[model samples]
Target: MPTPSYPPKPSPGDRIAVVSPSSGLPGLFPRPYELGLARLREEFGLEPVEYPATRRMGATPQERADDLHAAFADPEVKAVVASIGGDDQITVLPLLDRELLRSCPKPFFGWSDNTNLLAFLYDCGVVGYHGGSVMCELGRPGAMHPMTAESLRAALFTSGPYELRPAERWNDVDRDWADPATFESEPRSRPGGGWSWINADRVVEGRSWGGNLEILSWLLMADRAIARDESAYDGGVLILETSEELPGATEVFRILRCMGERGLLRRFPALLTARAKSWSFERPNNPQQAARYAADQRAAVERALRAYAPDTMAVFDVDFGHTDPQLVIPYGGTVRVDGPARRITVTY
Candidate 1:
């Protein structure tokens, strides 16, 4: 595969396309959608353009593909952002015009189900961002988390090596997006525990890959974004995070074991496991329960790494998943993991 290329950065006043390539929850929850768009204009100083299918629930894969094509093909739209992620983006991937996206590559920002598109773009040799959705992070109720906003600004406008910092305080519990009161204040948070590291003695640099674990598992089962040759991931940084669905430790192990069986785990020399999301609306875990959940999830990851790629350096709880104050990671772009120095830097 050819080395991936970085898309040109957009200026402050440039237009950005906001599309719903997965779910059109924007129609049901216009509050976050409107707030996100408003932030793009007021906070980020960029105009956000939406497509017809953006807010239309139950949009077909073909319709979603059309929105993606239109967003990337328009020269005026400097960047493409997902309104929010949904479960069915994997269905939309096969319908995309690879040639069109490759020819007119632009910075794409999204996470969760948008992992499908990010991985697809990686295969096409274009680096797409792995965080920064309009609704969840940008339209984040009260205001954009300070760290999230700062990191996003840097990723959008600048081109350089940006060091990532662990969040001082983080929240995994979500407030009701429908409740007007949810937008009045920031979500409750707890003091953040620092990152956990294993085999932390060397500095490794490579192209970044991986996203929501569940999404990647689906892609692997379908044999979609995964390269047939496992060697394609050699020297790549594998960054993964679980979703609010909260897959158990056993399930996590099974997925990594499958990746190991495919000869994928051994290819990457480094991994960044995102902070596991332990709380959800259905299972509102207390602080202690949440901690235990995170601990168990970390143990599962370590077990898999020890069995498959013992020498691969690992870092856990880097706060780039379902956690609040998420940072944007560059998919298929450069990531430098400095273990001894306890630092991580990604090329924007």
Candidate 2:
């Protein structure tokens, strides 16, 4: 197994390339995209440079791949971030230049479908960030969540262990990006339930792995980017989260069952399950429905663990994915899960 190395951190004044590898949501919803870029500059002190397909709708996979190549190869671009996530980034994976990306390693920030690229970077021995997309995190409704901003700041600029705190308040309901009123104020968030632990009797520290649960299922089905040898991921922390699509509990368990069947579940000593996103524009789930969905999903996860890696320490309702006030998880970087101490820390 190849050890993943942390890429160079970008200073405040450095140039960061923003590309739309998945969807060109920026083109469709300019308000949030522009707002996110402005925050990148005004708040973070970093200049955002957009690529050719960044704001273009329906761009070809090759075009998106080219933008990624250009961003990583550019000496002036300190890091690369996705404008937003889309469903078809899997198509762009084959077109990427493996050698070029490996040679000019830089921090790439994204999640959801961006899991494809993050997995690829991991295979190439580079660490990638699992959260901090420009539109979602940076352009968040009215203002960035303080916890989110702080975590991203450390992940972007620092090179050490950063503690992960459960969100004081978190929300998964998304507003209409097209509506002007959506950005008028912060998204409505509810009191956090804090993290739930299972079999958390020991501490486990390992390089992080995993991403969007559905995206991971896609990667597994396609047999792309995943380590050919299961041992490659041995001892790595599995970081997983559901997206706004809000898959059913049965679907979640089936996917984990498949992984377990392939002898993949026992590799990880610890698992970090992000808070399930139970609401979507299409579903418009009521509060009761949302709670039921999350509960079912958690039950399915617990069943899988009991059947496969029963002793694997597990934590749920973590604010690391899809939820408001998301924390950045370093893909292929170090994650220390101290069950006894009730603390989670990641190497940025």
lDDT of 1 by residue, 99-132 (tens): 9999999999999999999999998889999999
Could you tell me every candidate's TM-score relative to the true structure?
0.99, 0.99
Model 1: ten consecutive residues of lowest lDDT: 224-233
TM-score of structure candidate 2 = 0.99
| Colliding pairs, model 2 | none
Q: Show how many residue pairs clash in every candidate, following the order shown.
A: 0, 0
Off by over 4 Å in 1: none
True-structure lDDT of candidate 1: 0.93
Candidate 2 structure lDDT: 0.94
Tens-digit lDDT track for model 2 on 77-188?
9999999899999999999898999999999999999999999999999999999999999999889999999999999999999999988889988888899999999999
After superposing all C-alphas onto the true structure, candidate 1 shows an RMSD in angstroms of 0.7
